[model samples]
Target: MCKAVFFKKLKYRRDVLGDVIVNKHKCLYCGTCVAVCPMDAIELIDKWVEINEDCNDCSVCAKICPVGALGGVK
Candidate 1:
């Protein structure tokens, strides 16, 4: 209960701190982001890149993305 509440309250920080945002329409689905992510936070599912909480705003994926679809909010 307490932990849940804490997580819920801090959930927004997940994005501000380091969460990676993927723009599906612009994604090339070339698997570059997945391969370049140092934290393995980016995953190529079906035809899109998915960003998990494992990201640390390293920007590796963003820099490596050929289509400029990945962004980290550090």
Candidate 2:
């Protein structure tokens, strides 16, 4: 059986300014961020959540993360 690992295939990409940062460890793969993203920037691929470049750093995804796994780092 294959288990999901943190940061697997997910690149450490952040916006130039204060953008959304995903804490892989804290993420529950609940898809909350993906559903709440107004720009449709966050995606759940396999088991990893990917934030695409279309992200506008509005912090909507970060705000919706239930586990506090997403945030903005400035």
Q: What TM-score goes with each of the models?
A: 0.71, 0.73
| Highest-TM-score candidate | 2
> What is the C-alpha lDDT profile of model 1 across 1-74, one tens digit per residue?
69989887676567666677777788889998788778887777887667777877888888888889877566
Point out where model 2 deviates above 4 Å. 1-17
TM-score of the candidate numbered 1? 0.71
lDDT (tens digit, per residue) of candidate 2 on 26-74: 9999998888888998999998888877888888777778789988656
Please give the RMSD to the true structure for each candidate, in Å: 3.0, 7.3
Q: Which residue pairs in model 2 clash with each other?
A: none
TM-score of 2: 0.73
Model 1 / residue 68 / CA error / Å: 0.7
Worst 10 residues of 1 by lDDT: 9-18
